[model samples]
Target: MSQSIHTETSLPIEREVQAAIQGQRALAAYLATRFETQRIQIFDERNEAHQIELPTSALRLLVDILAELADGNAVRVVPVHAELTTQEAADLLNVSRPHLVKLLEAGELPFHRTGKHRRVRFADLMHYKGERDRSSEQALAELARQAQELGMGYE
Candidate 1:
């Protein structure tokens, strides 16, 4: 499923929501201890109960999501194979659309064209982002090293 990046998806910090999320997080943490799968019961407003089995991995993911929500952080789950428009990719990378297009044109990032529009795979975008972040860190380290060598008082 495709989602437009323009929509607001941030978590709300309302007290009631926070309380409910905290309770759910505690329950998820309890369920995460099960080895193979977890059997949980859900009760409706009418007191009707339904039982379901969830894999331990899925339970663990739920625990993580709930924890983030409890901490008032926005969370998104993007499939690795999903294709994103340039604007969406740019938003994810915290860059402008024109800059992302330039990267695509320069072959710094891979993209596929459908008609006249370019699409980037989520996995490829993440790979490029990781490399860019690592390169930036190395550059910062080198600059610090040079300043120290010159006795620029960076230490």
Candidate 2:
């Protein structure tokens, strides 16, 4: 029997949605009612929009539709954290200081101050690691399939 492959795909968020998420409150609720995609769009009063893509059974075309309406605005999801040092977060992610800071500001990983220093939570680090691992596994699987098709399996 042929092996069954399950692939996960995500659509790119528009640029306008990200702005709306930052500027308007009413727009968020309005879009929530109008759109039924697995993901939700964040927006602010300034018409800025951003998107948070959720893995759901929504139609594959929803991403394109949203992009057309969003006008390019899309929100990036940041993880909420409790308390952990910047160095600690970086160590867990195996990245440099500058990159970690960029992630924090880009809304990829959220952090806060406990006394006078920045901190991230253990949970967030692990979650990010898991995401990375999943991607790695997917790539490896694809590579293996290609190798087998070429009449070459592992040595």
Model 1 per-residue lDDT tens digits across residues 24-113? 667765773637887889899999999999887877777777677777777777788999999999999999999999999999999999
- Native-referenced Cα lDDT, model 1: 0.86
Query: 1-155 in candidate 2: lDDT tens per residue?
Result: 54435333344355556643343443333344444445567798998998877544333334444444455533232334335688867866889978998888887876777787777787877787788889999999999888888879653
TM, every model = 0.74, 0.39
Score each candidate by Cα lDDT. Answer: 0.86, 0.62
**TM-score for candidate 2:** 0.39
